[model samples]
Target: MRLLITGGAGYIGSVLTGMALEQGHAVTVLDDLSFQQDSLLSLAHHPRFDFLQGDARNPDVLGPSLEQADAVIPLAALVGAPACDVDPDRATSVNLDAIRTLLELRRPEQRVLFANTNSGYGSHPDAVCTEETPFAPISLYGRTKVEAEGLVLESGNGLAFRLATAFGASPRMRFDLLVNDFVEQAHREGVLVLFESGFQRNFIHVRDIARAFLFGLENFESMEGQTFNVGLSDANLTKLELAERIRRQVPRLKILESVTGRDPDKRDYLVSNDKIESLGWRPSYSLDDGIAELLKVCRLMPRRPYRNI
Candidate 1:
C-alpha cells in the first residue's frame, strides 16, 4: 500500500511513518516542518520513504502529493489544546478545512484514517465514553476535532480514532502530554506540580497509537464510517493519580498539590476502548512502563525547556 501522512514530521506522525515503512508499505510525508525538523531525520535515507515540505491546508501542496496514494492519514493540525487555542482560525482552517478538502479529493475506494481526539468528549458527565458518547467540547481544540470527525464520517469512506492522551518517547519528544509532562517535571526540577488534580483522562503509548492506525488501515473496509475509542481501558487516571504514578517511578521527586484552580484546559473524561479491542486492537504499553521509558530517556539527555509548537 502507498500511504501519505500529513504532518508526518511530528512525534506521532514520524513514528507512524516508520511503522508503515517497516510493514513494507511505501510512505510519503507531507509536513510544514513547523515544530522540529529532527523528528523524521532517521528516515531520510529509507528507499521506501519520501517527504514533501508543505502545509496541508494548501491544495497546491497536497493535491500533487495525493495523486497516486492508496491511503491518506491526515495528522496535520496545530495539535493539542494549548496550541490550537493559540490560534483558533488557523486550527479550523488546517484541522477542519484541510480534512474536508482531502475527503473531496479522495476517490470512493480510497481509505482515510483521521486522527480524532477523545478530547472531543470533553467533560463528559458519564465516567466512560464509547464511540456513541455525546460530544460536549469545552475548548477550541476539541470543537475543531469534533467538527473534523463529523466531516470524515459524513464522507462515508474514513475511520475516526478518538485517541486517548498519548505518552512514551518518540524521535520528536513532547513534554506537553500529561504523563510525559509530569515525568519530565519530576525528573528535571525534582518536583511535580498538580493543578486541578482531580481531572480524569485516559492514556496510551505513542507507539500503541501508531498501531491503532495500522489496525484501522488494514481493516478499513469494515471500519469505514466507524469511530473507535482507542486506548487502554484500565489506564484512565485522575490528574492526581497520574502525578502519583510519576512520583512512584521517581521516589525521590517531591509532589506538590495546589488548589488554586490554575487549569484552564480542564478536560476530564474517562474513555472506553472496548470498541477497538473487540476489533483485535490492544495497547502494548502500560502507564508505568511508558513513564519508566520516558524517565530513562530524560536521564540520558541534557535538560531543555519543554515546548510543543
Candidate 2:
C-alpha cells in the first residue's frame, strides 16, 4: 500500500508514517511544518518514505500527492478548542474545507481514513457515546471535525474514527492535550489548576492512535463508510481523576480546583470502543502506561511558550 498522510509531521501523523513504513507500505507525508516540527526527519533515509513540505489546503501540493496514494489519511487540522478559537476562519478552512477539497479531488477507488475527534459528542452525562451518538460539538474545533467526518462517511470510499483525547508522547510533542499537559505541568511546576475537574472524557495513547489508522487501512474494504469510536473504554476519567493518576508518579504535585472559571469544552461523556473492539481492534497502551511514558519523555523536552495540538 502507498499512503499519503497530510500533516505527517504532526503528533499523530509522524507516528503513523513510521508505523506504515515498518509494515512495508510506501508512505509519503505532506506537512507545512506550521509547528516547526522536525518529527519526520529520522524517517528520511527509508526507501519507502518520502515527504513534501507544503500546506494541505493547496491543491498544487495535494494533487500530485493524492495521485500517488493507495490510501489517504488527512490528519492536518487546527486541533483542540483553544487553537480553533484563536482563529475561527483558518480552523474551519484547514479542518473542514481542506477535507471537502480532498474528497472532491481523490479518485473514486482511493480509500480515505480520516482522523476525527470524539469531542463532537459534547455532553451525554448519563449515557455512553457510540458511533451513532448525536454530535453536539461545543467548540469550533469539534464542529469542524463533525462536519468533516460527515463528508468522509458520505464519500462512500471513506472511514472515520471518532478519536478520544490522545495522550502519551510523540516526536512532535504537544503540551495542549489534557493528559500530556497535566503530566508536563506536574513534572515541572508541581502545581496546576483544574477547571471543571469533574467533567469526564475518554483518552488514548498517541501510538495507539497510529495503530487505529493502520487497522482502518487493513480493514478498509469491509469498514468503509463507517465511523468507529477508537478509545480505551476503561479510561473515561474526569480532570481530577487524570491529575490524580499523574500524582501517583509526581507525588509532590498539588492540584487546586476553581469554581469560578468555566471550561470552554463542556464535553462530559464516556465513549464505547465496543464498535471497533467487536471488529477485533483493541488498545494496547493503558492510561497508566501513557502517564509513566510521559514522565520520562517530558524531562527531556524543552519548555516551549506555545503549543499547537
Candidate 3:
C-alpha cells in the first residue's frame, strides 16, 4: 500500500515511516519540519520513501501528496497540551481544520486513519474509559482532538484510534512525554520530581503505536467509522508508579515528592484497549521494556538541561 503520513517527520510518524518502509510499503511524508528535520535523515535515501516539506493545513500542499495514497495517516498536529495552549489558534487550524479539509478531499475509496488522543476523555470518574466513554476534554489540545475525532467519524471513510499517552523510543525523540520526561530528568539531575503524583495514565510504546496504524490500515474496512481505544491492558500507572519505574531503571536516581503542585494540563485517566484488542491487535512492549530502551538511548545522547514546559 502507498501511505501518505502528514507530520511524517515527527516522533511517532518518523518511526512509523521507517516501519512501513521496512514492511515493503511505499511511504510519502508531508511535514513542515517545524520542530526538527534531522529525525528523517536516515530514511531520506530509501527508494520507497518520499517526503514533501509542507503544511497539512494547506490543501495546495497536501493535495498532490494525497493523490496516489491508498491510505492517509493524519498525524500532523501541534501535539501535547502545553504546545497547543501556547498557540490555540494554530493548533485548531492545523489539528482540527486540517482533518476537516482532508475528509472533504478524500476519495470514497481512500481510507483515513485519524490519530485521535485518549486525552479527549479528560477527567473521567470511572478511572477507566473505552471507546464508548464520553469526551470531556480539559484543555484546548484535548478539545481539538475530540473535535477532529467527531469529524473523522462522521466522514464514514475513516477510523479513529484514541491513543493512550505514548512513550518509549523514537528517532525523533520527545522528552515531553511522561515516561520519557521522567527517565531523562532522573538521569540528568539524578532526581525525579513529582506533582499530583497520584494521577493515573495508560501508556504504550511508540513502536506499538506505529504498528496499530498499520493494523488499522490493513483492516480499514472493518474499522471504518469505528473508534478504538489503543494502549496496553497492563500498563496503567499512577504518576508515582511511573516515577518509581524510571528510578528502578536508573537505580541511583533520587526521587522527590511534591504535594502542593498541579499540572497545567490536568488530564488524568486510564483507558481500556479491549476493543482494539478484540479487533486482533495487541501492544507488544511492556513499560519495563520501554523504559530500558529509553534509558539506553538517554545514556548514548549528550546530557542536556531538562524542561517540562
Candidate 4:
C-alpha cells in the first residue's frame, strides 16, 4: 500500500509511519515541522519511507502528495483545545479548511482515513458516547474536528476515526495528554493539583491509534463512508481515577483536588469502542503498561519539552 500521511512527523503520525513501514507499506510523510522536533529522523534510512516538509493547507503540498497516494491520512492540525484556543484562525485553517480542501481535491478512487477527536462528545459524563452519539463539542478544537468529520463521512471514499484521548509514549512524545501529563507531573513535582477531577473520559494507546488506522485501511471496503469511535474499552477513567493510577506507578505522588477549579478543555465523556472492536481491532496497551513505559523514559530523559500545546 502507498500511504500519504499529513503531519506524519507528529506524535501519533510518527508512530503510525513507523508501523506502516514495518508492515511492508510504502509511506510518505508531509509535515510542517511546526513543533521543531526531529522525531522522524530515525527513519531516514528506511527504504520505503519518504517525507516532504510542508503545510497541509497549501495546495502546492497537498496536490502533489495526494497525486502519489493510494490512501490519505490527514493528521496535520493545530491539535488540542489549548493549542486551538490560542490561535483560532490557524486552527480553523488547518483543522477545518485543510480537510475541506482534501475532500474537494481527492480523487474518487483514493481512500481517506481522517483523525477526529472524541472531544466532540463534550461533557457527557452521564452517557457512554458511541459513533451514533450526537456531537456536542465545547471547544474550538473539538468543533473544528466535528465539522471536518462530517465532510469525510459524506465523501463516500472516506472514513473517520473519532479518537479517544490518546495517552501512551510516542517517538514524538506529548505530556499535554491527560495520562502522560499526570504521570510526568507526578515524576517531576511529586504533587498535582487537579480540577474537574471527577470528569470521565476514554483513552487509547498511541500505538493502538496507529493500529486502528491500519485496520480501517485493510478493511476499507466495509468501513468506508462511516465514522467509528476508536478507543480502549477497559480504559474509561475519571481525572481523579487517572491520578490514582499514576500514583500507583510513581509512589508518594500527592494529589490535591480543587472543587472550585475548572478544566478549560471541558471534555468529559465515556466513549465505547465496540463499533471498531467488532471489526477485529483491539488495544494491546493498558494504562499500567503505558505508565510503566513512561516511568522508564522519565528516568532517562527527565526534562524534555514533551508537551505539544
The C-alpha TM-scores of every prediction are: 0.96, 0.97, 0.96, 0.98
Candidate 1 local lDDT, residue 15: 88
Greater-lDDT candidate between 3 and 4: 4
Off by over 4 Å in 1: none
lDDT of each: 0.86, 0.90, 0.86, 0.89
Report backbone clashes per prediction: 0, 0, 0, 0
Choose 1 or 3, whichever is better by lDDT. 3
- Across residues 1-309, which tens digit of lDDT does each residue of candidate 4 receive? 999999999989999999999988899999999988899999999989999999999987899988978999999999898899899999999999999998888899999999999889888878988888898898899999999999988887999999988987788888888888888889989999988888998888899999999989899999989989988788898888989889888789999988786666688888898998888888989989998988877777788867766
Model 3 scores worst on lDDT over the 10 consecutive residues at 300-309
lDDT for 6 in candidate 2 is 95
Tell me how many residue pairs clash in candidate 1: 0
lDDT of 3 by residue, 132-190 (tens): 77899888888999999899888788888888888887777888888888888887788
For model 1 the TM-score comes to: 0.96
Q: What TM-score would you give candidate 2 relative to the actual structure? A: 0.97
| Residue pairs whose backbone atoms clash in candidate 3 | none
Which ranges of candidate 4 are over 4 A from the true structure? none
